[model samples]
Target chain A: DVKVTQSSRYLVKRTGEKVFLECVQDMDHENMFWYRQDPGLGLRLIYFSYDVKMKEKGDIPEGYSVSREKKERFSLILESASTNQTSMYLCASTVAGQGAWTPLHFGNGTRLTVT
Target chain B: DQQVKQNSPSLSVQEGRISILNCDYTNSMFDYFLWYKKYPAEGPTFLISISSIKDKNEDGRFTVFLNKSAKHLSLHIVPSQPGDSAVYFCAARGLNAGNMLTFGGGTRLMVKP
Candidate 1:
């Protein structure tokens, strides 16, 4: 079984503070993703890394960035956390497999609250 | 533009009844579709998937039906259990798109005992 673990289940930060969310996967998947879930908005991609040191901006990457220094770890960084940035963040990994189809294994998610 | 759409925001079903969740996509290039279940405070978990070539795929009590012509798909859960209550998200991936997925807004399923 594949396991994806997030650094925190809940977090609280003041406005303009820097925040980091960490994720680690045991499957050594090549693709890692960060997403934020909001009511009525679904899960919007924030950033994704296809390989170590390679990152791409997803649909909503503003005010957020990601790091993939190693194959097993991915981190999401908020430059300046704002109240609007409060959300449930999810990390997922997908193994490179046949035919462009790979099931994403996801972590439990971190709910961040900015005050 | 929202490529994937789930029109219904929520659905309620009696225990042991069938629960159907629908999803539509505007992108015709998507060849892979998936269903994920998410509980509060948890990330979405992969449930089942179907390829564009096949119209139907089933696993246990979950069945996914796809209509290529309409660019739509549906998930049917037989004998819905209370544990099935959660937000269900539909995701799609285009050919050669790697593992990136476009997801629907999701529909909350509530099962009554």
Candidate 2:
């Protein structure tokens, strides 16, 4: 079975503090994604990496950034955490050419709360 | 603008009954649609999917029906069970959208005995 591991299951950070959320996938999928899930707004993509060292901003990328220096690891960075940034973060990965047809494998998710 | 929408926030059904979750999209360019099921503390898992070219797809107890003209889709679960209680999200992708998917707000389903 494919497993996507998140570094933290729950995290609390003070306002204006820098925060990092880490994810690693054992499936060796070429596509990795970071999304924030919120009530009534659903899961909004923050950033995604098609390959190592390459990243693209998604719809809600204003408050977040991401890094994918290694193929299996993708990291989401919050330069200055704020109260509004509190939400459940999810990490997902899928194969390359078949991304459209392939279902994404996701981690258990990290719940971040910024005070 | 919200491209995908799941109007109902919650639904309740009895075990052995049918549960239907609806989803709608405004983007005419979206050709691929998928449904994902999520439980508390876990990530969303793929449930079923139907392409614009096809109207319906079924897997086990789950079935997805798509209506391209109306930009509407629905997920149907037959003989719903207690374990089927979860949040269901509807996602859509355009032809060139790659792996990026636009998701709906989600519908929470509770199956009671």
Residue B102 lDDT (model 1): 91
In candidate 1 the C-alpha lDDT for residue A59 amounts to 95
lDDT of 1 by residue, B1-113 (tens): 89999999999999999999999999999989999999987779999999999999999999999999999999999989999999999999988888889999999999999
Instruction: For candidate 2, write residues A48-99 as lDDT tens digits.
Output: 9999999999999998889998999999999999999999999999888644
Give me the TM-scores of chain B across the candidates: 0.99, 0.98
Quote the positional error of residue A20 for candidate 1 in Å: 0.8
RMSD in Å for all candidates: 1.1, 1.0
Candidate 1 DockQ score? 0.69
Report residue B98 deviation for candidate 2 (angstroms).
1.4
- Give RMSD (Å) of candidate 1 vs. truth: 1.1
